[model samples]
Target: MRFLLIEDHEDLGRSVQERLMLEGHAVDLAQTLAQAREFQQAAVYDLVLLDIMLPDGDGRVFLTSQREAGNTTPVIVMTARAAISDRVGTLDMGADDYITKPFDYAELEARCRAILRRRGGVADTRHRHADLTFDPLAGTIEVNGETRELRSRELRLLEVFLGAPGRILSKDHLCDRLFSFSEPVSDNAIEVYVGRLRKKLAGSRLRIDTMRGLGYRLSGT
Candidate 1:
């Protein structure tokens, strides 16, 4: 999943970004409300980890603006505000969940998964395409009863294709989804990852089809 992490604290933000990336999720870190808005406008995110107290302004207000603008992207607010009213206020302003500061990383990860599951209507973390089974959480792919580990990039690539089976995804769109805003990536880099993923899925029922001008699509034979 792609996530937008809006945080100001250097250490916490870096920790969260690294943790999420290690879990095979692409994350873009924004330090202030302005930066967060720019990132949010540039791409669609599966979820957002927002810190209520930002350098530029209150995160709740930014969330409120997002809601008012009809952006239904799920937001999980992280703040030191432990008061019940504070929590309620964030929820009322359209935060999908709230986590107080100094919380466990495990709890945050769990909440992210829960919210994504509910939104995606996917109870299980495993995604399937024909005879191929992909466990996003485990970062493994199984085909014909044989399981193999996937590199982080390969796993993310497969997730993108699996999410929209049989649909053509433009190179630009795929690049945006696979690489974070901060990462330097070229169209050729996307091709390299796609080639690697195709090689990995060799002999499987699922195939990646390249369209002349449209881009690529995942198809099952």
Candidate 2:
């Protein structure tokens, strides 16, 4: 998932951006309401972490504009205002969730997960490309009525590729998504996994295309 973080405090904003990137999600940070508004109009994000008190304007007004423009992207509002009225007002203005300032980093992560799960309720885990089907929940790959179970790493790599389809994802990005922050993985590990996945898909029409200086993409017939 891609996220937009709208915060005025540079230090806190950087911390949140680093943490979220380590968690494997693509993130973009905006320090002012004006920048955030421009980003919202140009790019689509899975979620937005909005600060109520921005340098240029109120986060509520920006959110209200988004709503009026029919942008239904989920927003989680963060504010220093702990008063009941402030909380209620933001909620009424269309914040999916609210977190007071000085929040736990872990709790914020959990809240983001909950909002995404609620927004994109149960995406299809079964992805299809031509005659091949990848079932993530079952950890199985099928081609021409033949199926085989995959190892855990293989499954994880396949899930990321299948989920994004045509997007080019660098090996570093892939590693971040496939493993947690503390896990130890070699620099060449992604290539090794890609090789294994290619072998698994050898008999099918689907293929992982490697772009020089860029990344790999799963292209299917």
Candidate 3:
């Protein structure tokens, strides 16, 4: 899933970003509310990881604005405030979940999965296409009873394809889900990942079709 992470501290933001990337989720990191707003305006996100204290504004107020504006994207507040009032305040303000700083990364990730699962109730994390079985969260795929480790980028690529099977997804859309907003990615980078995924699914009943000038689609043979 794609996420918009609003965090001011550079170190913490980078840490969270890297951790999420390792889990095969695309993330856009914002240091201020202004940047966050820009990202929100430009792209859609499956979730938002927000920090209460930002360089330009308070995330709680931002949270309030989102609710007032009817932006229903799930948000998880990440901050150092451990007060019970802080938790209740954010939750009342529309935060789906709250995590105090110095928390475990694994716990944070678990919270993310839990929140997403609730949002997409019964959203099957496992997908099947022909003889291939893909578990995106597990970062692995099974083909003909053989299991293969899918690197992060390949995992995200396959996940996006499976989300809209048989539908053509533009390169820009794919890029949106595969790379961060600031990552310097060339067109060939996506092609490289696509080629890699093609090889990974080589013997499966599913294949990727390239629609010249349009985009790519996953089709089952």
Q: In lDDT terms, which candidate is top?
A: 3
Could you say which candidate leads in TM-score? 3
Candidates' lDDT values, in order? Answer: 0.89, 0.82, 0.90
User: Higher TM-score: candidate 1 or 2?
Assistant: 1
- Please report, as a residue range, the 10-residue window in candidate 1 with the lowest summed lDDT: 178-187
Residues 1-221, model 2: lDDT tens digits: 56789998999998998787666555678999888767766556778999988879988999998888888989999988999998899989889999999999999998987786566464665667788987755678998888978776787678678768889999877876565333477988889989988988988988999998898999885
Off by over 4 Å in 2: 123-221
TM-score of each model, in listed order = 0.91, 0.64, 0.91
Alpha-carbon RMSD of each model: 1.9, 6.6, 1.9
Candidate 2 global TM-score? 0.64
Model 3 bad stretches (over 4 Å): none
Deviation of model 3 at 29, angstroms: 1.7
Q: What's the count of clashing pairs in each model shown? A: 0, 0, 0
